[model samples]
Target: MTADTSVRFREFKMPDVGEGLTEAEILSWYVKPGDTVTDGQVVCEVETAKAAVELPIPYDGVVHELRFGEGTTVDVGTSIITIDVAPGSGPAEEPAAAEPPAASVPTPTAPAEEAEEEKPKGRQPVLVGYGVAESSTKRRPRKQAAPAPEQSAAAAIQAEMNGHGAAPAAPEDRPRPLAKPPVRKLAKDLGIDLATVTPTGPDGIITREDVHAAAAPAPAPAAEAVPAPAPAPEAVPVTAGARETRVPIKGVRKATAAAMVGSAFTAPHVTEFVTVDVTRTMKLVEELKADKDMAGLRVNPLLLIAKALLVAIRRNPEVNAAWDEAAQEIVLKHYVNLGIAAATPRGLIVPNIKDAHDKTLPELASALGDLVATAREGKTTPAAMQGGTVTITNVGVFGVDTGTPILNPGESAILAVGAIKLQPWVHKGKIKPRQVTTLALSFDHRLVDGELGSKVLADIAAVLEQPKRLITWA
Candidate 1:
């Protein structure tokens, strides 16, 4: 390939999808070698620790090579694909174009020097997959080495093992076992060896299940001294078939687990619970459902419960704060990023409504509806899940009483709403069947004292008890 050639190739590196995320697992590839792709076209989908994000190709090009296959967890800065940005660059000519000229052919200087000469002058605009800091260093073209007979045989075996078109490793070293970063991390955590575990995934890849199976304890030996040559009884499997399934904690679930553990141990937690008659709140839910402003939006008991929590935060703004352990200070937030805990097939994810304190009742309801819909579809972006000041988890949907929920990391408080049931209660000096529910507020004791926590819970309960308080409180 001559440096003066007009055709140019660009390498697209994996980007950090989430804030400072180290790696992401490629879920699927939308394009392959030889396929034509346009700028801003989604080339692949990747699942980070927080959420699944689709990556768009930043420039128009014909795909030349996909460096990594689907299911591979690539680091943020590693190049994953090559694109021929120059028009009229045919797929068949890609290999020849990438190859250096013969030694006998005349050239001005070395390939690296030629690339340096061809490098664009001055500062270049940062491309989508490229990092902020641009490097002018040019890479020399790699020379193809002839393989020995033994190496050729080993390469064939390695290729078969990888199943997909991953390049084989060096002949002296065994090919690294194929597993996603999360699965590899799980193996490392359990001290299980990937080489020993049998792979069941496509292309002989180790899966999370394979790692767990390797971690399971072996059956104990019989204690009895058996007489010579007696036929051993057929060993019974310890685990019942399809009775129980073990899912490896990863992605959203793994992130939630880590955050919960950090919050539980780092911050001293204090929980306060209260049972309130929310008959008025339920009646208002029905009223709002019929109202013109709330039309075509999700108006439910949880919506009112969320609004009540917001009102309580407004009344007790001190509780809407976070503990800054690093800085040794308490950070009070004026605006509320209200998180609503959602349980999906992936796991528990809390996608918050940004600036919930600034939104009206109808606007809040619309945001809540959109948040729930996005979460249910597993399309919630990582940005929507960050910077939360407080969270409300409605356990009522599962027909359960309130739980002393753990505080979301960086947030001071979380409110749990229990199931609303009809119970006989004293109302206006007489026993009456009214809608009642329990509320539990858990907060970081370092930032919120028991008095403040109790006040916040009481405020929420009061708002629910008298729906008119929402109007007056605002």
Candidate 2:
């Protein structure tokens, strides 16, 4: 009897995943209620902390309910899915081979009350850290018991999850099905029954291809009997018009569209540009890369510029706050989600450091390196893509003079760094060679007025104009 006799259930809640993030939007569910999903299964993908992450189930069981729908922003610790384990199962134990209901269950009423009481009181009930309080006691042994009404109706539940009549078609055992909107839509449009589709993806996932094929019209049934009656003019012509074409918005295009729309709509943008003598800043970049303490750190011009911006942000925290419309208030944060505008094949994305204000120069350097690498690989999770207080768009890498880059959505400000070029300059009232670059600062005039914006911009230029002040960083 080492077998887990209790019918283990997985109350799969949303995880914060990083830096005390409290809420996430449900992008999609990979599993539905009454689905027989396995342990470590990706039951849903949630967009949290700016990244889209797949949540894995810790218990193997039949899903009982989908707590939320797509696009719903659920707080941490909210149960998105509930699982009901078969008898003779613990969290991950293999269910007994087709055994009848022979077990003991504690009186359901008390347990529900106790579970409700155990739920933490808060705005977001993220239950990841708290272990199952009830799992502390093992089930007491009992005689073979008759099926309860709930258990008897399990088949009815499964059929609903399958999205059809109760066991109308008992197809041979196959991988369980996902009951998402897209999946259901696909099944309906194709006239293909969901129960008949075999899932080949993780934890029995029915992929987009499966839906596509299912939606494809079945071949004509051998011209159907003696007389076809001209097939009613090919039944209104099955295909679209000759010039018609359909393209789904997904992957890089989808991400790009979303970013542009968000940035354009959320941030009230205003752009300002200033040419600067960055001679010292360029020289210091070379010197820091050679320093013993900074060895192995990826040194780029952006490092010094970032340091400059951070220092300036400390002087002007107003630029790093968010506008709360419903509350009719401006929320100022002590920490910074510093967004670095990255241009990739997927388009322009502004992923930020969670608390960039807390890191040293070395840590910041490492963070920048990792951000650049991850963005290039398209592996930047949805969590990395949010809560940006302000953004820095480095157009210098593309060898441009300067441009008024649009503000990232949800951000009030963006600074564009231009290319550094050797040019003639006047120092000590004389003409000489100097490293020149332009700095552009764009801010929402409503949240950040000209005075504050100009001061921050000037502070950044001053740091570049004289690079030694970085020694006294906040």
Candidate 3:
């Protein structure tokens, strides 16, 4: 086929993959200029406000160019890839005038009954499906006849209405909301809504003002971030002798402070704790560490527990969903990026293990071990700390029995694994030396409810209580 004279370039900009995520760091590029790509094929990996996301080519065409390299932080709506295509590219050219969206869809064509029959059973509704076949870029290729500006807008509108591209552009392509995922989550944690906050971010994006506006009470005087403890008789030591002293926050502690404040004000958080018998999990960890085949694998109970949580999330995906108000949708993830919260000299940090679901217990053990070591050494890269669906904070490492932990920003839930101890417990209907630990669950109540959270917590406890259950095979 003769190339259409002067083909139009479809510039696909990066969009906010997660709710309220504004910017992402380019992690890796899988395609380069002059390369061909198909729809739904991964072209690049981007670390978003919360997690590292893999972006797929929305259409089948030759990749004209990858605008940014790895490690670049590009804002949402910035065109990251370009595709050359004729206006009439995919499928047979239907008609110039498309039918009104769904509203005027033929009643005869309505197959609510038949379509419902084929819908997957027991599956929760999800947004961000395979994505669209094409996108509506701002640039318009020259044609034989010049169309009026109104007609161009109309045509672009039609593309969105027809689902050939993304939803219509926002009223203005203004600077995106500047709030980070952790900050957005902080607002969520505190039940603070962002829309109302006067955006201090570039352009008109909601700023921290939006959060302060919605909150009934202002925050305590800015002070240094010290160790946060559950309400206890021994009050946390203040920065100085004063009731609350100002201590300049920096590094991980500063980042954590900002995120906590944001999540605390915006999202309504709920926490619950459970004591569990982890004797079997400990035994399994010891066995795996001693296994010849598992040599070099950092086997630990935390790894087994992480795997159990992954399994539980698969069984209850609500724990892995994002609450997106813009689309009035729930984004349920199919993959796992498990985060392990670490307490380092820099303070509490969580660096995740990407694609945790694909890993075996041995792999998870090694990754977790490496993650903790890296975090403790203050050598964790930002990429390692990005894109977590669910997290587990091993608070028990500090000898704490159990406590209600704060929800990590962006993630829907975090499992607080308390200190493991040799305690007396009922075994075989009699008291015995049992390795025990407390499993505390802190979750975003808006995205995850008590029932769903309880179900997941119970599943994790069950697996740990009987580690042999993990390997029950025919």
Candidate 4:
């Protein structure tokens, strides 16, 4: 086909969706070759280490080619797709044929030559936050060059010594096993070679189950010495069956696992539990639900509990801090980004409410509502999950009594709230039923001593027991 010289092609590269994320896996593509696309229209969805994010095309164009297929893990700054910005431009001249390269170059000089050859013909400024530079590189006419006899001889000798005389295989020409990044990682972790595993997934894709089956130890041969004994039938191979299935951990689950492990190991955690009577807090929750100001807002025990925690933090600002291991110091935060640990279908994600200390009760309720809704939809942004100072995990929602939760990475403490149950207790010197719940506070012992943690926990318990303490303490 003739080249359309007048048509300007734009390449869109994979971007770092989260801060410092180096790579992402393309989950799916919304546009294909020759499809008309508009500026700011979502072209693909990618799953980064943090979350699934939709990428929008920056300029209007017709899709020319998709460089990578879905489920491919592409590094940041790698070209992912090409678009013809001037698709209506008339076709121009036929491109010149590429000439054969000179043979027998020294290994050290090859990289430099490749770099020079790949240099762009022109450069243009990229859109902000896209994370890739625009290059206007045009194909240059190549000139054929013949190798020297001595150089060819040297290359052959070198290749012979390496046990491979054939030219390196092109990536597209080679048979690459079809598997998602997570499955590939699972195979690597299990020490199973993907090439040896039989794929069972759609389109000959290798799955986590296939990797695990490959990694399973083979049955040992029957002993020759037991010839007289009846022959033992071949051992049945264990397969992932109806009773059990293996799910590959990836995206948010993988990140959460790493963060939890790091936090559990790095922080010297000290957990303190207190059983508090939260009758007042429950009553306040009901009152807030009926109040005109809280109409259409999420009004629950968690809301008041969050407010109580903020008030407690205000009273004990020392609790609102993080241990800076790199700096070898305790970093105190002036403002609270209150993280509410949300359990989604993907995994446990903690998307904090920004500047929660500054927000009024109504505003905090609204933010909480939005955060919960976004998290349930699995659309919590990576930015929303960062910079949390303290976190609250309400195991109570699941009918659990209490738990000593591990702290989120870079944060000092996490509070676990248990189910509020009505139990018999002495009220005004008489036996009566009261709303009681257990609260567990886990903190970094390095930054928060027992006295400080106890005070913070006590402040929260006091506010729950006496709802008016929020106004008074504030």
- Candidate order by TM-score, highest to lowest? 1, 4, 2, 3
Per-residue lDDT of candidate 4, residues 77-136 (tens digit): 776776656554443232221222112111111111111111231222332223222232
Runs off by more than 4 Å, candidate 1:
2-7, 90-246
Candidate 2, run of 10 with poorest lDDT? 113-122
Of the candidates shown, which would achieve the greatest lDDT relative to the real structure? 4
Over the stretch 80-189, how does candidate 2's per-residue lDDT look in tens digits?
Answer: 66566542332343223222221212112112211100111111122232211111112344536654565334443343223333322333323234543334555665
What residue runs in model 3 are displaced by over 4 Å at the alpha carbon? 1-246, 472-474
Kindly list the per-residue Cα lDDT of model 1 for residues 91-135, writing each as its tens digit: 223322222221111112213211211222122233322222222
Task: List the global CA lDDT of all models.
Answer: 0.71, 0.63, 0.63, 0.73
Clashes of each: 0, 14, 31, 0
Total clashes, candidate 3? Answer: 31
lDDT of 3: 0.63
The ten-residue window of minimal lDDT in model 1 covers: 101-110
Which pairs of residues collide in model 4?
none
TM-score of 1: 0.70
Candidate 3 local lDDT, 268-299, one digit each (tens): 88988789989988888888878897897677
